[model samples]
Target: MHLDNNTNSEGQKREYCSNGASRGGAKIIKTFSSRNTTQNLGNNRFNNTSNIGAYENNPLIKSGRVSLDKTYNSRTNSKFNNMIPTTYETRDISIVFEEDRQNAKHYDMLEETDDDIIVTGTNCDTPICFKTWEDMELDPRLMENIKKSGYIKPRRIQAFSFPLITAGYDIKGQAETGSGKTAAFLLPIIDKMLKLKFVSMRRTPYALVITPTRELALQIHEQAKKFCLNTPYECAKLYGQLEKSSLNRELDGGCDILIGTPGKLKDFTKNLQINFSKLAFVVIDEADRLLEFNFANDVNEIINSPLCTPISKRQNLLFFATITKELERYSMDWMRKEVATIKNKRENEVNNKIHHNIINVQGLSKNKLVVDLLIDEQKQAEESDLSLRKTLVFVERKKVCNILALMLMNYGIKSASLNGDRLQKDREKAINEFRSGQITVLVATDVAARGIDIFDLDHVIVVDLPKDDFMTYVHRVGRTGRLKKGTATTFYNPETDYDFKDNLIEMLQNLGQDVPDFLQQ
Candidate 1:
């Protein structure tokens, strides 16, 4: 196992090893070589003790292998997997659709118009607390559904987002996933679709919503239909591994709205069966997830289609809780110039957000640590007479997920592994069992992590800390304490140290959450 090492500002040795065990069940003690020594990494030998650090400034590993700079691939060693190798190359192309492109460019710039941007100067000074749909004046039927669904008031994000969307302004909204952001955009699209006269085209929806996971696409479609109930508009979901005969029939018959993932949508589009030109409102839910799932190229193709038009000319809404610099760069290149950005409250007390501390565990047994926490939570649940809802345990590898699930089952704790290796049917079944209270624990990878939004999740356990960006750490923990309602715990082995954990603790403290003592070490 590799140990993450560090040095103090004074150039003294620091604890930088993860707590792991030897094959014989003995804890391994990792130390840095202070004396000048050359250590072999792969095929090359460098001074492992040098001030600049061993292998410093080397683009390739000691074995002289070139390393890609992509964060996820670099951290997860995805380069070695069956994952596709992405090559970056620039291209200059002619704009055959020059008219539409100009329109898109103009609108992109228009988004920044000071007089037209209602959210700019006002909300910059205070938290939003107004009725989000005060201006939309949704159809009575949709309002009735919202009432019946027990939604009495709009969330802080919804209050500001609804008006902008209904007014036909392009939006770049950043809010928590469960903060009613889905309905904030969907309600307006459904409202608009209902008012437009229906052209007799079957299966083709006027509005298209894209998400990273099939589960999320279905979830949004259900919510969208609920809003358009009793109206003339109809919504359909398209995804992989479904009966194609039925989907094609629905397309031929004409639908008012389409919700699907990129892969399935791309397949349909290539077959010339799905029409994009008629689409007016395009929604990309969980936009960050699109890139993480390796769907950026596909999403770009969809955006560049004749139907999507340019960002400036078409009505577009991109919604996701986490946004990165890479996403911003992509947006600036493709989205309208005047995109209205609505940011949520930063990690603060009012928001009640929590972040984890990186406890550098060195030479400790990870399995033993996990067992201890599970036992503790089990005991507490029993004492409180609380029926354990579902708990999600995250792991980095499929092999680990299966092994952990088996271990939990051997302990008489019902658990299952959900990963890409499993068949789609099996994955759905496991999720159903977890959601229906049949199983208490579900072990998954990051792909499933981004898609799951189960209400009232009992807890989230991070068996492995992500080596990717800090944003991924946020998304991992984001699975728990949803709406600030639960608790989350991460295992810190001995190899891991307190430096990263300290930064995480500060972030959580700023977000108004309590820090655990174990992490303070």
Candidate 2:
């Protein structure tokens, strides 16, 4: 049947176009038959006249019968005359009759199918990975904003995380960086708040999102603002760099969703007396990083404060690129006993879209090598008539980060340094400059660049391989190839990085890339 645009009883016009037969019509017909059989069996079981009279007299049952009668009458009165067609071919679009659309309200048109992603936990319903924005049935206003934001569909992480979160499940989600994790948690939370008609109150928020780094927190806050545009909801951000007076001003105006770092949020809860008793949702973004020893105390203080809602009363969400034992332990301590865990099945697999190249800088000056690489990249971009390719040069130490950035500038390559030693404003400036294409290269330390999302990043140059952890390499390379194809080159010092040679070779082989002869040796 060809699907066409139709207005439902609520006067909301929705397009139900699809190819071939209508899935909604088939489900409605099946449900109608099943319900009829159930009613027939109940009538037969209560055949006795006295029992029938008693059942009919019951107020609840009588009301239900009247409601069903009204619903049936309404359907018969619809444009289709009570007949729901399975297929109506008109320009190859399937049609759903008005009555059938109303009946299908309680039934979901999309069915859940198994895929590579894994979701498991106690008190978890069958996972429904929403394939499209329509499957989510979000607020029309929110959906409009989503379209304006230029998102055509939900990412895998968003697809799996939405249904569970909207249904009030505490979730621990693990996905790679740049996988739309922020929106996965934000959209559902905002939708629920809108449905509940939540109002922003002074110093009290309906949702709280905590992240480890200021950059990540700001990024999340920026996205939240975009999603909340034209809605009554208000969003506020707090971090070490933000002044107390600014935060106070924001709270005084009102806040519905508060995003911040652990230390700054803890300070507000203890001193400013910002109440979280009414918070319905609490999200810890980058959970694996936030649960580390340095952030443990502040996180504990913020979540455990009496001003905050108890763990049992609020829904908690933890999202991270990597899952660690410490994160598991923290979840056990703070999250409910029946928390839902959603993990991307391809988390361990390297992205084959990224072309991996290894350069053996055996006793040679690495600075000259990087200069040559950047110059070659620029030449290629110019030849292709494309913009200068954005690149991230990862260094192991802060000293190296600064030195390399300065050296690049001296060589007429626009470059900036991002490290822990820089002030918050400087860090923000560097990131902004890099994003705006003012600087082609961002020399960064792993700690400062973690969880920062940059779009259209073309290349990642690893000046030094992470000493021990293989996951660090994964994260560093993850910055590029975020939503498209990219490249990564790692300078390997056989003597300094000897311990990671085997692991690096295994990773390269798994990703379907050729292992260099030096590494294989």
Candidate 3:
């Protein structure tokens, strides 16, 4: 269902860069000087005002500087001009302060240790070798389908979970969002169901797949259809926002596989429109997300429905990117102890598929600064030959999202706002247009960030600084960087303290991304 909320009527807040410098061009430089200074005589050889470096035992200061000049080589280790004197100067200190605040939050979130703590699920520390479809002994036709889709090897999640799933064993698959968990369960389910001569009971879904949001449900349905193209396997999507009568007809005709969001699935079951009496396999995609406080009750009731449970103990597959303490308890209680738990390593995963960058601007005026960035991007897109089609800009609040959408439309950029406030139909239309290149820009709230999967997106803009949480930041950036190569530009006010920016940089480093120097101010 399209969730709607009150949009903020206030205009964008005006904020100036704490420092007059534009984020357009900046280079991070590392400078080191030889120790050849006499005591009592000044040894400073570079401008140390805005950024300073202290020497420890070795009587020379080295500083890393970021510059935007095309000629600026950040990778090169060089010395500052020695002839000039070095002195500490004051510039935009806001970014420095912001960094400190962010660092404090990061430290607070850590388990008060310098070591990696296993937060959830079993840590499979072994090196996971991804397997090819042939190696996995998947159905020949299915393997051909995977190849046609350009998927020669199974992703870590699929490689680990598919074998157990086909063996009729219940399993829990844990991996990050971009790890291809959907296909892990879909392939095995299709293979098993295609082996059957007939689908059981009219108006009953034999296999039920529940997702947290409609967009995600539709995405899974589309992917399943691609996999089952030439086969007898039939998959249909059932969600509330659609016409109930038409959906009921599909169920009555008999569907081999059914995919839907929690609320709609429960409604159909309650009305006795869909039956799961013959159901064999149950898959909960993004199980942890569906179990969030917002959708927990609905998801639980839907899972408990008769259609989801078989006459005897059935094959249950649960997939979640990250599981919290509460979700862990629920899983232990619901899933049998003997179930195979597959956790894949994501070290090799990179959006070789996505180009990521950050715009570190200095200032307290976040909203206004973001607007400026969006406008600049729009100009670049227009100047180009429609190359920047299918762009998504994220906002922190629903109100801000609406305002930004309005602002973009006012500037002749065909844009639509998507949030809980818009009707489901409106959201669907907007998403379709964005995908089709009808609308170039989509201003969205966080709701769209997690569930919606848009392919071949040109750009993803985080209009405001994401919370200190890296997972939240990852989800926002994940919107654009699908299988195809894409670009992500995150905006941040420069006044953030050095430590706060370092915390963010540290998180990105752990994720294996190169943090842009501008943000490290």
Q: Which candidate is the best by TM-score?
A: 2
> Across residues 1-521, which tens digit of lDDT does each residue of candidate 3 receive?
01111112233222211111112333222111222222121212222221122222122212222111011112243332111111122212233233223333323322222111121233345523336677676667776677666554565567667667776667777765455678889898887766665455566666789888877887788777777767766777888667867787766654778898887888877877776777787788877777763677776676676555742367778887665787777776556566777663442133333455555434323344444455555566567544445778887775556545544443345566666655566666667666655567788887676756665565787776566655566677777645444566666665543444765566556645666645543
Candidate 2: worst-modelled 10 consecutive residues by lDDT: 28-37
lDDT of 2 at 234: 84
**What would the per-residue lDDT of candidate 2 be over residues 269-349, giving only the tens digit for each residue?**
888468898989989888777765278788888887887899899999988878877778888877888788888777655
Candidate 1 all-Cα RMSD: 15.4
lDDT of 1 at 12: 42
What lDDT tens digits, residue by residue, belong to model 1 across residues 383-499? 768755567888888755654554454344556667766555556666655654556888787756764666457567776777735566567777764443444556555355344
Better of 1 and 2 by TM-score: 2
Please list the C-alpha lDDT of all candidates, in the order they appear: 0.59, 0.68, 0.58
User: Can you rank all candidates by TM-score, best first?
Assistant: 2, 1, 3
lDDT of 3 at 212: 83
Q: Give the local distance difference test score of model 2.
A: 0.68
RMSD of each: 15.4, 28.0, 19.2
Error of 2 at 57 (Å): 97
lDDT of 2 at 487: 73
Comparing 1 and 2 by lDDT, which wins? Answer: 2
Per-prediction tally of clashes? 37, 11, 44
